[model samples]
Target: MGGRDVATASIWDAAHRRTTVGLLTLVTLVAFEAMAVGTAMPRAVAELDGVAWYAWTFSAFLVTSVVGMVVGGEVGDRRPPGPGVLAGVVVFAAGLVVAGLAQHMAVLVLGRAVQGLGAGVVIVLLYVVAGQAYDSRLRPSLFGAFAAGWVLPALLGPLAAGLLTTHVGWRAVFLGLVPLVAAGLVLLLTGAPGGTPPADAAPWRSRAGWALLAGAGIAALQYAAQRLDLAAAGIAVLGAAALAAGLRRLLPRGTVRARRGIPAVVASRGLLAGAFFGMDALLPFVLTEQHGWSAATAGLPLTAGAVGWVVAAQLQGRRPDVPRQRVLRLGALVLTVGVAATATVAVPALGGWPAYLTWGLAGVGMGLGMPSVGVLLLDQSPEAERGANSAALQISDATASAICVGLSGVLVAGAADAGGPLWPAVLAAVAVLTVPALLTARVAGRTVAPAADPSCATNLGR
Candidate 1:
């Protein structure tokens, strides 16, 4: 678990190379999809006449991701990370096609859910590959590279999505990704005998049980957001039970409770991601509603944030001995400032700039925080369990993101009925996140120093 086992993780270089190529492609797709849709969704909503359903479509992908991450972790632990990554890419791209071709809001939501499952599989395995194939020295660079890959989505996605929606149609947004995923599959599996490592995997019953729990729970949450009726409540309860069973199967013991060390780290990833991404999902809406800004204008500020992340990641990767927890705390503080800045929206002079500032700043924080977490989580993993443990960390992100986004949906809907002030919704979202950010900062502060035992970096968030 310590020195020798950690060192052995570096032996899988060819595997790592293959995985990086495949995952970079996957991340590119995710980044593009998220960014493009953000810009396009407003137009899509107008056409679809279903503004109420917007949040659920995004949340559905995320909630199902939780289960996918858990299952991915379990399976990644049991087998090579390659095949899992391939399968995920295919599933994700296929869902994109479905979404592009959809005729109704219901079908679009279904597509998002399917896409979410694939996202989980791709993300966990990508992280698993990093944790298992890279050592302490190499891991940071890989994480940085991963972040860099994501920047493409954050940068070009909005512009492309907006343009595609404007010219071709919103459906073209989904249509564009099919070839990329297919090409990636070919590149990743080429020269291999059986293709990516087949997931001989655990029993079907176990897999089905977890899937049922996650799929149903997310659907329930979607319904709950739409209506707070007794039916929704009952469905949510059942879904919660299913999720519990799934988590029990997928995560390490005590992860649900956030027991110390690695489990704590993993849990923090979920909450941290939730606190950040959940609020972010609504920013485009805020801009368009509050400032009457077009999607393209609203998305440009993200360029600055993306650049900042790329710069920070490069710096972090170069400094191999930097304590990861400090990096995480630094990111949290920057992000908290970013989140809290939305209060400035009350000023008309500032216009939507506050929203853009906050959104862009959060991107920088994420860039700094995300890769550091990936590196640390892998550092904590033992060799045999590297893939599994790495997957767990990512699952934490997906699960928490889903829940947080779903909760945000409920809050936004509630706010919509009562004047629909953007700042109030922002405040509601930021308020819940502060608790986790503080906790994350504290834990990050403590664990970071042990990564290198530096005196100065020891109390970064303390």
Candidate 2:
């Protein structure tokens, strides 16, 4: 046990310390931005008189992020992750600056789109770096640390952003991240490798074109979801078809079908993200409007969940003897239970505090399952394919979460008009999403692949 403890502690040793810290810091910055934006956005929209376009603010970011992920994946496959990370940081900072100075909501949305692109690139590159730089034994710990990095941001980002928006201005939230992005760039460049892979025979332009189509289709679908007319329904159907076609070409061939092996892993990621994030986006609104809580108070459940996520991730990382697939299955089950428990908060008799506990439970499930998916993807992919596959994993997650959130918005809006509790609609949407997650969990357990590295094979031998 002592020897094992020493081995785990070595992730922060001189040989690995720089890259680990750089990556963790990068993740922390992203987490802070995401949480802070959520807190600040309501004020920003009100100030800009863009209440009608509220949903588009988030949808724009998510849709454009697909384009960024595809481009980053191709870049990482053909070159080192360092260059892509640097480019992403620069672009992300530029977006932050644009957003900070924006006087209109349209400009703010465009700025967010740019930020999403940069974020997509940065996240994919980070995954590639993990695949290329870290040994298999260290991957779990690295992923766990990544989750842990979110802890502080999740705890403080909302309260801080609320304070800033209340006293200073919402623009400060966007502007403040610029310096952090610069620092992250320096750290990433210093720690990450600077080598290029052999060029691919396939043309990246074609893949990029498909990614654009996917993004457009997703955006259209989100727009359509906001309307209730038959015309909007027709548009949504057309958008879904386009999205499916583009994804078929972009992801692994079997991804939509959830074929065993890497495809199942990717599908599971989508299901998990859709189920969790869709509900997460609505929780604050539900708490504030229905339960009459302040934004800071509503955000407390999110903080609790972040803490739970890190704890579970740490526990999973320490137990490498367990199968990654088994962890995924167990996590999915736990998440289902948590989601179900959270729905009870909608009952007037139960009140809202139960959400703090249940959402944390949901976070624990995510911590257990989410990192394991990354490990499984790395385990299954060849070194040459890591970048592309990592992009697929992220694309799946982004697309699913976007669609589910859009649908939830429609449902909640309709419920609000019907003069009923909106929380049940949000909870129902989340509950429905869990079906795919639960089904995919079993499929994920059935598919196994050889380890990416020989040294790590024993750890994944199960």
Candidate 3:
């Protein structure tokens, strides 16, 4: 059957079933680990007496992951997806083992850095796998499935992690996932295409150097965000310059300026991720501290948001007739509105329940925009450049999210120090993020040259 025909048939049709299942399983495993570990981190830090290094736990992962993404993309472009993915799984599982057995917070942080590296490699390879194994027609569905994979994890990961941490110990949460990692590895390997070296190898060493510099810059910014002073501000300027310099070398040309086409797609990914995730990182805290909601009640908004995301993703997947740019613009507008509405939770009269709804709307916006960017990225990317471009997309997201979250932390801390309301500051941060999202909406609308491959359908005009 033709690729389009196969796509119209079903994602579960015999021809596509194995890859679909494998990719979904990989996403699920990753999603579950992310949610579970985040939930258990507080206890883990307390037990290790590393409260001072608490933020590093996350920062370590974020920084190292940038290196992994760049390396994995290079590897994926020059070699088969299987080896890179398998290696990532092995590294990730080893990190889990080390973390599970750690006696000190330092060791745990080290393990987390290793885990971040593995996650970075695995995610980039997965994107390459999708680009290679699936046709354009099926790509949207595949991306939608990837988003849906997060739903079960979002619903259950925290609960399961809590239970295991309470009864079996937090260590079990790390060790127990090792087996699932192995299972995911098997599926990925089976589904991945055989090794066929590229005609020309990607320049790895230079990219690696740039990635390292970028990682260091990001680390510096993370540290600076925690401190509020003129000296820190000066240091932050240096860090930002370093980050921009490294990004220029690592990402496609004009990415820093949000140039039309691929650059815009990459820019939008960063803006969307920063606004949504930064807001997300603060929501639970906002509810508990400002509105006196219980932890579980505060978490409800996140759950609602996840559901909204899945619904919108599925909707977008089912309706390929809609122009991808239109979907992106619509999603961005929805997200801006949702975020603006969510800010109202800061008001005394609005109460907290509105957050559950507004956040869900924001989730819907993310659901619509995120997958569209993926589809657009794949659509615009030539076969030879898919890995590198995919890496750029993910790297944009990781870097932007880290910076935005850091900024939000600074805002919240400054608000607390001033004995003022914290939500307004956080809301201001969220509001500021919407500008890029809105501005990039038009940039995302710009067209790109069609893929060089004739067999691949072009959605730019459609």
Which one wins on TM-score?
A: 3
Q: For model 3, what is the C-alpha lDDT against the true structure?
A: 0.82
Error of 1 at 20 (Å): 3.4
| Runs in model 3 lying further than 4 Å from the true structure | 1-4, 200-205, 423-427, 447-462
The lDDT, on a scale of 0 to 1, for candidate 1 is 0.69
* lDDT, model 2: 0.81
Give Cα-based local distance difference scores for all models: 0.69, 0.81, 0.82
Better of 1 and 2 by lDDT: 2
TM-score of 1: 0.77
Q: Which stretches of candidate 1 lie over 4 Å from their true place?
A: 1-19, 34-64, 93-114, 165-172, 189-208, 228-245, 287-296, 299-304, 347-352, 355-358, 420-425, 445-462
Q: Tens digit of lDDT per residue, candidate 1, span 1-462?
A: 477655544323564566557656767777678667767767766777877888778777766776667667666667676777778887888789888887777788888888878877877776766554456777777788888887867777777787888999888888888898777666555522232333444343335356546656666666676676668778777767766676666566766556655776676687678877676655655666667889767655556567767877777777667678778888777777766665565355778676656667776777777787887777776655665666667656766776777787677666766775766775676677656666666666544324444564457647
> Of the pair 2 and 3, which is ahead by TM-score?
3
- Between candidates 1 and 3, name the one with more favorable TM-score: 3
Q: Kindly indicate the candidate among 1 and 3 with the higher lDDT.
A: 3
Q: Specify the poorest-scoring 10-residue window by lDDT in model 3.
A: 447-456
lDDT of 2 at 200: 49
Best by lDDT: 3
Indicate the residue-level lDDT of 10 in model 2: 50
Clashes of 1: 0
Order candidates by TM-score, high to low: 3, 2, 1
